[model samples]
Target: MAKSEDFPGKPRNAPTWMSGVGRAPAELPEPNLRVSVKEMLAQQQVNEPAAKQAVADTKVENSQAKVSGKVLETQAPNGVIAEISTTNIRVSPFQPRLSFNETAIEDLANSIASVGLAKPITIRPIGDGIYELVGGERRWRAHKLLGRETITSYVREMDDALAQILALTDNEGQEALTEYERGKSYAKILDSGGERSIRALGRRLGVNHSIVSRCLLLMDLSNEVKAILDTNPGLIGGKRAKDFIEFSNEEPELLLQAVTAMRDEQWTQEHALRWLAKEIASRDQQKTPSKFTDKEISGIGKVRVDGKKVELRCEKTVDAKRLAEHFEAFLKTIDRSLIISE
Candidate 1:
């Protein structure tokens, strides 16, 4: 029993086991932690006031250990800190963030390896020995990277909705999650029957209603556009995504072409807008008749050429077979293989 006296920066009121146990081993290759429950119990020399009482009152049942007068249970009262096995924790199904930055996770792992975890992850007991992550996935991942068997966690009692909200709030504050991801999170909650309306959902999550509405709007984007956004989350913002959705409604085929070009060509929003404008103008220009010629032929009723289309109104008495023969002969003069008929 090293007692709280041996651990530097130990909280005066904390039990001996909780104080110095937070530090990770100096070397990654070593399986030993700075302090292990078995090693601490081996000494049997508790000295601190709280540590003495905690050990005296300790109890064990169903493979659950009681230390500091607290039990790690699924129905335990909220706000308990415990050292738990990493293998027993499960990722939350409500995780809104789809992508994690590997470089950032690596940096975090290196930092934790150099200096022990500064903050404990938040989790809620879900079963006999299983816990579901509420927040701090990055920290959990870092602990995994260090090959640690256990992690320090702040345990809580929360329902699915609360757990999901906390997870979103945690990541939103820590990193730059794209607006699309944020919106997707909002949509999930709404779809889960958690909130009645965007306004209510925003109020519950403490986000602006407009922002929530914008995020939901992304759900309406074409699958093609959504696929692009999935891989490149920062491709277009909520406002721009709305623009795309609206443009797609007007000209889906043309918009898909432009969106594909936007991704491949690395186009700026302004460039894409300009390209769309030019293309629309060119199409409209083509529709306008730029050339027209009308003349009365001696044998034929009349001849007219409008842009690329030509029409002839044969006189009522004109021979239909003769006119067809003449037209076929005229087309042959232009190309020997030319033929007319359906």
Candidate 2:
């Protein structure tokens, strides 16, 4: 038997599809007749055996596209002026919003001029001749500087979010990318996704959350400081890198100056930090008096007693006789007539 809610006014024998359609069946099968999962598996094995599958799916989805194009031309896109692509292919518009050191860029430009672009940049076509850079903007810039007519590129159609992720991953895979580049990539992940949480980004990238967070923090530092960090691998340990990030916002200029001094003057982290503290204190104008008084001996000597306990101190580097003469002169100034001991 079935309730009215279960079957409505239709017959219990009515087909499931007929229940919703115009026609109603006269009767329905008992619910107890449904097959169990174990029975289904047994029947399936008898009909067609299951096979093991590979752990990772290497095949790219068909909906995605990949194409090659020669470096037709390159142009400075947006405020990022420097290089051009060979072909005006349509690409995703998600530009990597980060800055690079002019010095580094110049080095890259020189390398490109000398060796040519070693790798092709990836891009996804948006529409028409306009293409969005997926990866290899740096390479593109280099090639543009070289005035190369044609270069290799991979073009695909990807969603905006996926394109950004792909760009980030692609950049990260390159061994040549500097620490600053890695930091910029992490920053891009935060900017693209509303969740600027480093932990979440690290989980997505299959890396430890702290690493991602530290890299992102590095990006907040000025380029001059970042350049120093890049040059001197030992300026900050893993622990200190995190500390630097915490201070980036509060004392960016000081941090930059300190980093510059550390690199230029070959100062240790402790020295740089001490100088920074002193500068900060001076800015507050909280000065203190000197601890030493004029009466204190300026040199080393022994103590003696006449009327009062007196100590002999010397300023010049001389023998005991010269020191004695200095003491006699001092006594004459005090009394003009006093027995002196040799």
Candidate 3:
């Protein structure tokens, strides 16, 4: 028999009956219940430390990603102060940005050098320690030309639309835009949520509505005409260019030819338009009948009838009696005719 102390909750003889004669009824081993619970808790503890370490590392990396650079300390370089020499820096190919006269740039450069940059350029970081110019490219250029290294600038984080506007403002203020440049800039403004009408853009730029409309038309000209204008900006004024727009698309080749002729021969706008008209007429002649015709009369002279009017033009050598007789016969055939002129 097992003693009560040997089996804490069982009767002394119960162990023996249940199992064999108890030599302490084969004691069951204690189940390892804490093992799984302790393991799960331990794993959670381990993950907590790892998560904390990861957060710390991420913060440190973020801090290290900030932008860093200093402005150049020297005066602007000479070439940089002048107009942008690259033709590829167009605002829009179809509608170029306006251009300012050289005289204006020179004046502004002199002012800037004397008094320092009145307005700072705006730039935004593009990555890899480089910054894309947002605005004040002209000022930046001038400073570079003045042998300057460090320039006064406004560093901005901007979206595409704002960046374009800043760039345009800077270009416009610095007198770096051409008429075409002005037109394109106006177009950008029109497209960028400010206003869509040419008149509105003209108002913003302080120009007439007609001028703005003309510039818009110029946006549609072929590259050839644009090239000529770009080469010699003063070749034609806004008014002439406006008139040229009327013919640019319909007669591109002829328009270009006229522009070339005008440039080479220094022809006036009137002469160029007239020459273009004549060329157009000649081309039309090839496709259709003659616009004017002459008819000969027997025993008389040739007369011209231009659809609306009939006249007899004779050389001095013609006989007056024969001409008079033919005229009388012609009038008789017509029955009743009015001759008011002598």
Candidate 4:
């Protein structure tokens, strides 16, 4: 067996898997990965001491108690890497991440094909010969690309709360996860029987408390807005998301308008924010009646609203027969708010 290695990066609870693996050998036409599973395992087993020494040499003084506890669980008391069938592992259902960059994953698959997996994914045994992933989904995915039957992993007993914490902390470290994704994770953690408060969640995420709060608001974003954000990530962040959400509250149509502008105009975050703010302002401006609004009635004269009531003024040239028609037209222009409030 090869010397065991840890996962390449931190943990995230996002969803991703390899697509090309399901293809038949004829589709590949030739070998993809350079080494056989047996050879790779042997190489890892042979390099164990060097890997451990490297870890020891790089180790720094650590005082964070929470980190220490989690770290202890990641590696067993004897510190040996274990292997199990890939069929036994199940993706975590509570994962907060919904999207993954396809290009990045493909590159990882290519790397694994050339050399082999550098790090083992973390998993906790659930039952019935199954395990749930705690971290290193991408690595698991790369292994899937190799079409291997077994995966190298750190196996341990973990509760839902600790699994969640490990997944969030690991994910937040590696990529620019959408604010919506991160927020959804925070909401899930909160939903996990109060294991983490907003402040505690923020501390774990290494973000401000307000940032955590803003991410939660993402859950309230209209589906249209979220779909747009999903395809165009840098298009919105927590702060910009708050702007779109505020506009949505004013009038749901206003949020839709922002989505349309963002899609059709290909707006930058600044452009979208500015447009939403201005549109909301314009709609707000048109809402309240000023001192008076005049609607001309052509032949009959004009109707004026002096805020409280409608006043009809007639010109000497107008006939009285058209009076009802003009009055009906003026009714459409009347403020419905006062009537509704009553």
How many residue-pair clashes does candidate 4 contain? 13
How many clashing pairs in candidate 2? 23
* TM-score of candidate 2 relative to the true fold: 0.44
lDDT per residue for candidate 1 within 196-221, as digits (tens), equals 88999888878899988887787777
RMSD of 3: 21.3
Candidate 3 ranges with C-alpha deviation above 4 Å: 1-67, 71-111, 188-211, 230-234, 261-342
> Against the true structure, whose lDDT is highest?
1
Task: Give stretches of model 2 more than 4 Å off.
Answer: 1-119, 175-184, 194-197, 218-239, 245-271, 280-342
Q: Give the lowest summed-lDDT range of ten residues in model 4.
A: 63-72
**Candidate 3 structure, TM-score to reference:** 0.51
lDDT of 1: 0.74
Where is model 1 more than 4 Å wrong at Cα?
1-77, 261-265, 287-342
User: lDDT for each of the candidates?
Assistant: 0.74, 0.57, 0.58, 0.68
**Arranged by TM-score, best first:** 1, 4, 3, 2
Which of the two candidates, 2 or 3, achieves a greater TM-score against the reference? 3
- Candidate 4 residue lDDT tens string, 1-342: 986555668555443334444544445467657874446546545666664455444422231111111111222432324576777789987666676777788888898788877767777777766778888787777778778777777676667888887787667656657777777778888987645588977887678899889888877877777776666644567556777677667767766776777677876767766877787789779996688888997766789998678887888887666876876898899999867754
Clashing pairs in 1: none
**Cα deviation of 239 in candidate 1 (Å)?**
3.4
